[model samples]
Target: MSTPGQPKDPAAYAGPLSGRRAQAARNDHAILSAARTVFLQNPHAPVAAVATAAGVGISALYRRYPGKEQLLQKLCADGLRTFIAVAERHSDAQPDPFTALKEFVRGIVDADVHALTVKLAGTFTPTPELGELSARAGTLAQEIFNRAFEAGALRADADANDIPMVFEQLTAIRLRDEARTAALRHRYLDVLMDGLRSSQGAEALSAPPPSSQELGERWIAPDAIMD
Candidate 1:
């Protein structure tokens, strides 16, 4: 028998607790994977679809996510974190700062394309947490840009803030089919990279472009028009 003042054997209790934690981790991973797959195929896919894809019951999914918005918030946060990590890794690994910047830009675009809901949700209603993630990613991007400029790989007139504008332009490319969309995105990315090069034989831009804050404010979702 255990003493009244002493605890039970830690190993005896650890088995059940560890099993529960492992199951919870598996459920979380499955739910997130299912949500990402569904969202990639159709950003407007219902929560039921995610549950079905995850092989979990609706109740189980709800128990973990509470609601669709909460699930989306988690997905967005994960995607943003991944994007920041990729940018940091590329920036640190590449010897050529310009190549690093290009890879960073490509990484962001790839993530944005895959996480369509996350990208669109930001335009309509961004949570403070989401904004914070974006700001952190932007900081890494600015560092890459500064390094490229110092290395004479990027044009002196290029603005770090223009990175978003470049992404916005890339996102505007639409096609009737996904295949064409992917192809065009790559082609345009190459064009954008060329324009960013220091060797571009053109006069320096006369004025600065709009700030990132201004761009964000201007992109508020349109409300219904009254007759």
Candidate 2:
């Protein structure tokens, strides 16, 4: 005990901390991989069940992923990477950027059947992790829009900076129940694309005169006043 001045046990200091960090990383990976399987098979499974499936204790799971929102946020972000890879393949193969952009949008819309998106949109508030996912998604969407813009697929007057934000809003709406079931979402998306098209093309896709004042009010702003 009198020899305490000689650099007391470095191994004692570093061992547990290093092991804990490694274990945490391993546990996080195992849990997420297990969650992916459980989520796919039973999207509604309880969090405790996910922890059980991962072969980790509930406390360990919580230590790695604090709550349901965090878990789902990570899941969606992971899914987006896979989804984007698949979408890029299709988008890159198309000859026309306009067709490619439309197909890319369609592919994402059709592929939203993954339960994580459904659960996150319906249940979770936007936490920091979710916000981070959105930020990354914005970057990916910008790349897609930039490619389209370079190909002259978007109107020259429109701001390329606005596309990702606009796309996010539209995608959210498309994921809603009423919006998802009907062909109405596809029609609405076409109208949105038309709005961003060159003047001649926009005029061509313009629908027949509004059938009623209600329809007119919905399509054309009642706030629009003539001088």
Candidate 3:
């Protein structure tokens, strides 16, 4: 007889175990890729849509993710982690703080994670991992902004919080049109980057902009206008 935790048929168990692990990994990759695509097209898309796109059964998807909410949470978590890593990489690689910030924004826009996350922002409560990632990203962004300011690369009035609002505005560009999306993002980002610079040509603001908290509230509720 086999031990309690051991398989009775070792050969059979080994064959299936290895195959199942490989198959599960493939399924996970497929599901995540499909989720990113489908959610990019429609953030409120159903789990059935994701399963269909993934070429997997609904049961298979549910086995990995209990529901659409769980899948969305996972997607957001993964995107946030990737975004943070990209930011860190750019920050470390570029000696000029302004160049680093520009590269970071370019990377994020190219990744299209910001648009997806913005679409799903209020749909689910953030998991601990997601929350932590967001907080860390925020801190990193602040550090980058500070460095840019000290280097005289950014306007004295600019705030780190303004970056997300710029991202939110950029997300309005139709991402489904890949060529147009790329062109528009680069064009607008150039304008935004120029506006952030401490050049004498920069226009002075008439009044103070909204706070980060105000931006958050307004972003989550598009219908609410901020004065």
Candidate 4:
């Protein structure tokens, strides 16, 4: 193997991709990012909306995704994987518990993952792979929550179930510019962290935090809902 920072063979993988391949990769990234933003803003939007937002031709998009369900599946899978990767990385970097928790929160916000749930949830049945990923993601997130609480970094009244709802609330804040909205959301996240931390003057929550099952029940498809 090569040194820690060096590629095993730079010539094989580090140089520019072929013109067509490089362009394809860029287009794919643009399409998926645009799809996430567009669909989250309006779940009922047409596939052509994604193409327009991505600045690519409709044919190009159809060639890659074939249909809106496929695109939604890919976007949600990407967001889930992003969450898993962030959690795994931070889990290994165990320093100050609350600081790690805050970093984890920031990483998720940067991913802007909760938007997928806020709008596109239940739009398509999840694939088996997506189901597996969701299971792993939940485990990692709860581990992070447990670590903070066990270390007394997090407040007793703040349960792990509060995490998703807080992130979802952030997703509801829309602005004309993405960067501006992110900045505002992050500013408020700092305020949230202060409240979450265990403090002498912390007040008890008015009600119990949502249970994990209840938080999860929100994603159940309309067909699966019961009286």
Q: Give per-model TM-scores.
A: 0.68, 0.47, 0.81, 0.84
- Candidate 2, residues 81-198, lDDT tens digits: the string is 6555545565567777777776666556545423345434444445565556555654665567677888777876555444433344454453346545336557766877767765
- Per-residue lDDT value at 102 in model 4: 80
Order of the predicted models by TM-score, top scorer first: 4, 3, 1, 2
Higher-ranked by TM-score: 2 or 3: 3
lDDT of each: 0.72, 0.58, 0.76, 0.79
Candidate 1 C-alpha lDDT tens digits along 154-216: 788888877777877876676779678867888999999888889857788788977876756
For model 4, residues 91-207, the per-residue Cα lDDT tens digits are: 748688888888888778777777675577767778899889999998998998899999999888888888887787766677999789989889888888888899988779899
The candidate scoring highest on TM-score is 4
Would you list the rank order by lDDT, best first? 4, 3, 1, 2
Angstrom error of the Cα, residue 60, model 2: value is: 11
Error of 3 at 100 (Å): 1.4
Off by over 4 Å in 1: 1-21, 109-118, 122-125, 165-188, 203-210, 218-227
What would the per-residue lDDT of candidate 3 be over residues 1-227, giving only the tens digit for each residue?
A: 32211112234334455677767766777788788778878877899999999899999999999998899888888778777877787776889889888878877777767877887876666777887888888788778778887899988788777787677677668756778888998899888887888888667766676686764553343444446
Q: What is the Å distance of residue 125 in model 4 from its true position?
A: 0.7
Q: How good is model 1 by TM-score?
A: 0.68
